[model samples]
Target: MMKYSTSPTPSTSSYPRSTSPLPAPANYQPTTASAAVKRYKYLRRLFKFNQMDFEFAAWQMVYLFVAPQKVFRNFNYRKHTKSQFARDDPAFLVLLSVWLFLSSMFFALCIGLSSGQIALFVLFVVFVDFIGAGILVSTIFWYVSNKYLSVDGAGGDVEWGYAFDVHINAFFPPLSLLHCFQILLFHNLLSHSGFLACFVSNTFWLASIVYYLYITFLGYSNLPMIKNARAFLLPLPALFVLYVGTLLANWNLSHMLMDFYHYRVL
Candidate 1:
């Protein structure tokens, strides 16, 4: 019987054990889990209405319209006190969602859409147009700012949630313009197909886009650790050129949008 002694494994066991932990992957990040936790907490707070600061949110909305730059002061304060650039409260998001729902519903009704169609339109606009598109845009800007616009030794980075907040803040004016104001003016003024209608509608769009860009600039510029925030405003001239091009081409963007919505839901 050839006895292979299990204890005779000195060759295998004699190697020195490395006390240093194995290196993590080059791209492995713990911040991903922290971000996920923050996102989860934000979503969880959505259902807890009693815990939301709606009145402050309403004030913030008003400031977003009248004095958007002032809104960032609160974010700055939040950074100082809470040590984060993003809002923990979901009141703003909830209020914006409610406003979006109401505005889209009324706009659909004004366009003579059927009840069922109106519901679908609302869903498409709120979910697809607002939330979905907002997330995409936020992610793009977040990545751009973090990857490209970051300073070398700033010791801080842009927060994805903060980027999202910036997007929604910028999105508010456009939403009001296109969904609420344009609908109000549609039958009376914008329904006509002419240069005058084009000018009015196009100007609304231009102003709304300008508002979006300006607010976006303010949001990024307000971040203490961010640099070259003026890059956000670079698109304005291009937007102006496009606005002119659309006008010269006699494109009734509002009409085109209405048709698109009709095609989608009707």
Candidate 2:
């Protein structure tokens, strides 16, 4: 009896309501539960690389090599050349090598004059090879994906960003794979403390072989036209042999330089 009737418990229709239709969802809104899972599955399948590591390598290379248009053109060159290591930006590579070498020397001199200095130099070299090589590999991927690998046989005409989509996709695997090899090389190199580390630095040699194989496989796999595994491997073996010759040449040059310095000091 003491309780009020609460104004007839407020009829369901008593609440204020808008007469206009509800707003549509924004375009950038996240997918719902089922759709989100589906989207993730597709993304995972597409990338086929370690997500976080690949992303880091991609970002590093992106910052290091950010030419908008020419980056993709290089891929076109690679497609025609068939596994040839075409030089896109020689000046950039030379400048980076010089900068890294000089910077390492400067740091080595500043820090100490012992095996420790050499160790630091080696670390710097590894960094340059990993990050610098990362940029190169990313650029290559961008080109091939844009030029050769296509769902429909019709990619695009040679425009400014003919390979923009391919470039975006290329940023990940090559860098990820390269970084993985770099780690392996660093581990092997650091484990020893001599100038002529065992077998003339086969760490990078083997790593490069692995990297080349992966790139060839990736390119062939993505493209419907060039699916012949045998055809792909033919060019790769020759490239690998050439790379070995280059490695030996580089080693001999470094050895001679060191010997000259030692003689001059004596």
Candidate 3:
């Protein structure tokens, strides 16, 4: 009654009510769980395990070294259309990495290093041989492929990662053989039969080298960019050159390491 001429009271229903939820603020952040889930999914897909069968993949990997031609023929590069930037089988790459690591450890163990020293040696091999050398060789192959091979008219392009994939796949057989020879040599399994040991080790080494050359040749020959045999053979000389250069570069370091092992552990 104080203000007798009262207007309608400004009640809670005076303004309109929103049916939709409010928009997230500009500074809004996702929950940690949500982010982790997304990362896990991404990693799984990237590694190609989402679509791969473990047993089949393992068999195929073994076949890659044993029956390379059959494996190569079965390989369909076009299937990896999603990997326009980087085309490689993540499973194969991972297997190769693991093999490298295990081979390094085996060598270190054969040298009779202490546990701590073996661990360090394995780390060195993983970092220097696997990571560093892999990157260097892959880069070289990529450059050679793009520069020399003309892919302009071809249906497919030579991606850097794909080139690396080819390089690694082609060389894997030789690497495995070489590792086997090293293991045998180090373990003295055939030490009593010196001639047999020498013959077997040399056979493995020679076969590895020959297989590497043959595989590289076959790999390049099948490329879309290389049309003629002459063009196909061009990469071979470059590969040999790179191989020799890499060996020369690492010779001193390898010798030093061997000497250290012999003096300290053997």
Candidate 4:
């Protein structure tokens, strides 16, 4: 037998040692500022405003009013998918808010509101009445759907985000029409028209509002989770009450502002 060397021979490895640096930690936490910047970028992307998007959104707004079922059927809830609804687009909402603000400002000017009153009107009517109310109503619907009814066969809950999309799309047409009527009236466009024209315009506005409510009813009725008529009807009363209450609150706020302005002037 060959005598084995007592000393170990130098090892000859064919593989080179890994010179590559180890990968950074997979769960590395971003700095707070970096995270904030990421969110800002995300929001910018989500709310991107372009002329084509605006035109499409305007068309969808009309389509939503004319053929809501088709619109709802086509609505994409996934953030990754592109959406036509203004509610789904931040830029659209921003545009809408700006339009509302300008409209309210014009109304205030037409009414001869003081600067303070105009400010209040912009704050309350544009911001609170429209945007805030949309959010609040959507939340209410979302809560009612989740709390009282099983939305899907799999017990999937109604998401507030989707509720908001539905609510805003269904709600905005009538609301915008109402604003348009106000604008026309304030600008004396209706004054030049005969009584019949005025009557027709007012009637149209009222019909549009009724249609808005009807569309809302149809919206909830179409949900897969709403199994029976009773389930469908349950949410209606609350929604109607909320709708009426919003109108009353807006009226009251306007009157109160006018009264306060007069008092101050006196």
> Using Cα atoms with residue i matched to residue i, what is each candidate's TM-score against the true structure?
0.85, 0.30, 0.61, 0.58
Clashing pairs in 4: 47-91, 151-225
Clashing pairs in 3: none
Which candidate tops lDDT? 1
lDDT, candidates in the order shown: 0.83, 0.39, 0.54, 0.53
RMSD of 3: 20.2
What are the root-mean-square deviations of the candidates from the true structure over C-alphas?
Answer: 17.4, 19.5, 20.2, 19.3
Clashing pairs in 1: none
For model 3, the stretches where C-alpha displacement exceeds 4 angstroms are: 1-52, 77-89, 189-198, 227-266
Error of 1 at 110 (Å): 0.9
The regions of model 2 sitting more than 4 angstroms off are 1-136, 151-200, 219-235, 243-266
lDDT of 2: 0.39
Task: For candidate 2, write residues 36-103 as lDDT tens digits.
Answer: 44445534544333222332323324432333223323343333332221222223233334444554
lDDT score at residue 238, model 4, on the 0-100 scale: 68
Which of the two, 1 or 4, has more lDDT? Answer: 1
Q: Which ten residues in a row have the lowest lDDT in candidate 1?
A: 5-14
> Which consecutive 10 residues in model 3 have the weakest lDDT in total?
5-14
lDDT preference between candidates 1 and 2, better one: 1
Over 4 Å off, model 4: 1-47, 50-52, 76-88, 186-205, 228-266
lDDT computed for candidate 4: 0.53
Q: Tens digit of lDDT per residue, candidate 3, span 32-137?
A: 3333453455456656654433444455467666665544432332222222323223666666777877876777776667888887777766777666876787
Q: Rate residue 202 of model 2 by lDDT.
A: 46
